[model samples]
Target chain A: GAGVSQSPRYKVAKRGQDVALRCDPISGHVSLFWYQQALGQGPEFLTYFQNEAQLDKSGLPSDRFFAERPEGSVSTLKIQRTQQEDSAVYLCASKLKAPGQGRNEQYFGPGTRLTVT
Target chain B: AQSVSQHNHHVILSEAASLELGCNYSYGGTVNLFWYVQYPGQHLQLLLKYFSGDPLVKGIKGFEAEFIKSKFSFNLRKPSVQWSDTAEYFCAVIRRHSGGGADGLTFGKGTHLIIQP
Candidate 1:
């Protein structure tokens, strides 16, 4: 089975430009998550979605970050204005069940590395 | 706020050497623990998780982690490591969301393991 996958494996964006990263979760996964990993650091949570509802966005760094999963399978994380601080690897993960359903494993994607210059 | 700590930032061991990486988290409430591995050039993959039941949980590839609630720790151990086990290991925790709401995972700084054959 195909695992979670993110598009645009690498991206270089100018400081004020907008960028959107896409994620395709596993076929039947209803829970999806986003994370950010800076160099020499582990990934930090970004946001989470259950089906098409954005359940948690507390981890997002700032208001410039926004995410949506309209169809519940594919998600897009859009940054309103790229910044040098936004340079990092953006990871996407998906789980088969919602929180507290007893499953705890989340399959991750290759992640998209974004560099803002 | 919950925070995870990985005691070792980097570990180097020869093939067939015993390995143990320490991880501790700070959160008084109920939580779930997980260990994830990321091989070079690959996505993050789950090694194991501890939600309930026995404290010792075995994961893929000869790995096991013990959750010590009293100590606020979930340490990953392997009797003997292989060269292929060289990768980045991360310890993560999530607050138990029982009824409905969802939350994001809080990950540690991660351990970079280098195996020498």
Candidate 2:
């Protein structure tokens, strides 16, 4: 794919239901990121991955929110017992890693809009 | 923790109007700054970024941003805006030395720009 891709463009789940969002990052992208964007707000970091390593999960809101990139190519963000407050757009981004470089430009996906009813 | 602030929640202007959007960060150390634009029903797209050197950085769509270390600000500007430029703008930053473990961005509450014809 030329850009990051996310599945289930829109999801509506009843409160307490579990929902899973998927993200497929650009091929060979070494860094993947997840973010949550509430209505009228900017996207907030949720977690980060360097290949298959879950190097950072501090941004996950709670224990119920989990993310994994097992094979380093695709990632999934699962929310258990979804609450109304969980209704927001989930964004996925990826970046190529440059040796010795501290940063690189990130490419973003269309995002999946989740609505907890 | 680093935090970003975008002062304008909403801005309205007519076509060909000069445009400026303010963004400030609270980080004290070296940081990378970025501006992203999200059009209606479209994915987020990078407008520009500031990594090092020249304080002024140019991006796609004739947009540019200036990084002022003294003010901890990276403000976006354009000489003239068209109706097609109406979109939500976000400012983001990442600590330079955070390494691969903490590569996610901290974003500000977005500014909504409306350019009327």
Candidate 3:
């Protein structure tokens, strides 16, 4: 793909429902990141992956949020028991290589706008 | 935890006017800074980044940012503005030696810039 691609550009879910958002990073990107952006706010880091390993999950808001980038190509962010507070835009981004080689311009996807009622 | 702050929540400018956006970060050690813009109905795109070397960094669309170590600031500027420059701008920073484990970025609340033609 030319850029990062996210599935279900918009999702409407009822409270307590479980929703999954998928992200397909650029073909050869080695670093993948997930972020949550609320209305009128900047994207906040959610989780990070280096290849197939989940190196950082400290930013995940709660137990309901889980992200996996198994196999190092595609990633999925799953939210269980979605609440109204969970409504936000979920963004996925990728970088060409590891974190700090002095090259860290992450390319972002259009993002998935999730609405929990 | 490193954090970013963007002071101006909204800015309005006319075409040909100069533009400036302020961004500050909180971190004791070396850090990587970046500016990203999100045009209406589009994904976020990197504007510029400062990892090392010169403090002045130029980016696409005639945008540039200067990193000031003492001020802990990386402010974006454009000598002239256009209607197309209207967008939401974000500032991000990552701890320099946090290892790949904390590779994810900490972003500011964002600033909305409106350029009228």
Candidate 4:
């Protein structure tokens, strides 16, 4: 793909129902990130991966929030026991490589709008 | 913990008017700053970035930003805004390479700009 792509432009899930969002980053990119944006709010960092390594998950709000980048090319963000407060747009971004000592340009996807009822 | 603040929630200006949007971040170490713009029904796109060197950095579409290290601020500016420039703007900060996880960015709440013709 020419740019990062997120699936299910919009999702509606019943409270307590689990949901998973997918991200396909630009081919060969080494860094991937996931973020959550509330209405009228900035996107908050959720997690970060570097070539299959989940280096940071500090931004995940709860234990139910989990992310994985098994092969390093694709990533998934899964929320268990979804809550109404979880409703927000999930953004995915990828960079050509790790940020440090290199050009750190992130290309963002259109984002997945998730609504938990 | 690092965080970003964008004081203005909404701003209205006439076309051809000069514009400046304020952004502040809290971080003790070195940081990389970026400005992103999101037009209605569109994805977020980078306007400009500042990694090092001169404090002033120019970006696409005649947009520029100045990074003030002492104030921990990165303010975006445009000599003249057009109707098409109406959109939401985001400011972000990335931990220096030494801090690691450079891919993750902490973003401001974002400012909605409305350029009326």
Candidate 5:
């Protein structure tokens, strides 16, 4: 089966430009998450979705970050204005269902490397 | 806020050498611990998890980790490593959400392991 996948394996943008990153979760996964990984560092949580509802956005850094999953399967993380600090690998992960159901493993995508110059 | 720590930023070893990677987290509440691995050009994959029951958890490809509450550690170990084991390893933690839904994970800086043949 196809796992979670992100679009545009690599993206380069000017510092003030806006960018939208897409994620396609596993076919039946109900939980999806986004993370950011800086060079030589680990990934940091960004946001989470349970179906179409944006359950958690606490991890989002600022107002510049917005995410939506209108159809409950495909998601998009939009940055209003790209910043040099935003240059990193953006990762997407999906799980089969809600947690505490005796199964809670997230499958990750190859991630999209975003570079803001 | 919860935070994960991976002491070793990089480790180099020869094939067949024993391997141990240190991981520690700080959170006063109950949490789920996880280990993820990313090979070159590949997405992050689950190595193992420790949710409940036995403290010692085993993962895929001859890997195991021990969760020690007292030390706040979950170090990964392999009796003998292969060159194929060379990759970046991450330690993550998820705080048990009271809402009965999934939560975002806090990850460490990650450890880059290089194995020579």
Candidate 6:
């Protein structure tokens, strides 16, 4: 793909249900990022991956949020026991270079808007 | 942890009006700054970026930003705005060397800009 692509443009889930969001990064992109954006707010970092390694998960808000990029190409973010507070847009981005290496812009995908009822 | 702050929650301007959006960060060390815009029904797109050497950097669509190291601010500017420019803008920063969790970006609350014609 020419750009990052995410699955499920919108999702409606009941409270306590589990939801999974998928992201397919551009080919050859070495870095992938996940972010959460609540209404009226900017996207906040949720986790980061360099290749298949989960280099940074410090930004994940809770233990229920889990992200994995198993093969360095596609990634999945799963939220267990969803809550109303979890309602937000989940964004996926990919970069061509490693962190701290040089200047590379992160290209974002059309995020999945999740609504927990 | 690094944090970003965007002062303007909402802004409105007429066509051809000059525009400026303010952004500040909490980290004191070396950082990379970026401005991203999200149009309605569209994905987030990079507007501009500032990394090293030059404090002023220009991006597509007549957007520019200045990185002020002394004040830890990266402010976005445009000489004129059109109705098509009405969108949400975000300021983001990446810590250069945090050792463990450096890859993910810290973003501000964003500014919702409405360029009225």
What is the alpha-carbon RMSD of candidate 1 to the true structure? 1.7
Predicted candidate 2 versus true structure: per-residue lDDT over A1-117, tens digit per residue? 799999999999999999999999999999899999999999998988889998788889999999999999899999999999999999999989832356579899999999998
Instruction: Report the C-alpha displacement of residue A79, candidate 5, in angstroms.
Output: 0.7
Candidate 4 per-residue lDDT, tens place, A18-108, comes to 9999999999999999999999999998988989999888789999999999998999999999999999999999988876748668899
* B1-117 per-residue lDDT for model 5 (tens digits): 678989999999999999999999998667799999999989999999999889999999999999999999999999999999999999999844556545778899999999999
Provide the lDDT at B37 for model 5.
98
Clashes of 4: 0
Model 2 lDDT tens row, B1-117: 789999999999999999999999998877789999999999999999998999999999999999999999999999999999999999999733355424788999999999999
lDDT of 4 by residue, B15-113 (tens): 999999999999867788899999999888999999889999999999999999999899999999999999999999884333454558889999999
CA-lDDT, candidates in order: 0.92, 0.92, 0.91, 0.91, 0.91, 0.92
Cα deviation in Å at residue A86, candidate 5?
0.9
* Candidate 5 docking band: high
Instruction: Please give the distance, in angstroms, between residue A8's alpha carbon in candidate 3 and its true position after superposition.
Output: 0.6
User: Which DockQ values do the candidates obtain, in the order shown?
Assistant: 0.79, 0.71, 0.86, 0.84, 0.82, 0.90
- Superior by DockQ: candidate 1 or candidate 6: 6
What's the distance in Å from true for residue B46, model 3?
0.6
Candidate 1 TM-score, true structure as reference: 0.96
The deviation in Å at residue A46 for candidate 1 is: 0.9
Error at B79, model 3, angstroms: 0.9
lDDT of 3 by residue, A39-86 (tens): 999898898899999888888999999999889999999999999999
Highest DockQ, which number?
6
Q: Weakest 10 consecutive residues, lDDT, candidate 5 chain B?
A: B95-104
TM-score for each candidate, following the candidate numbering: 0.96, 0.95, 0.96, 0.96, 0.96, 0.96
TM-score of chain A of each: 0.97, 0.95, 0.98, 0.98, 0.97, 0.98
Native contacts kept, each candidate: 0.80, 0.85, 0.93, 0.88, 0.93, 0.95
What value of lDDT does candidate 5 attain over all alpha carbons?
0.91
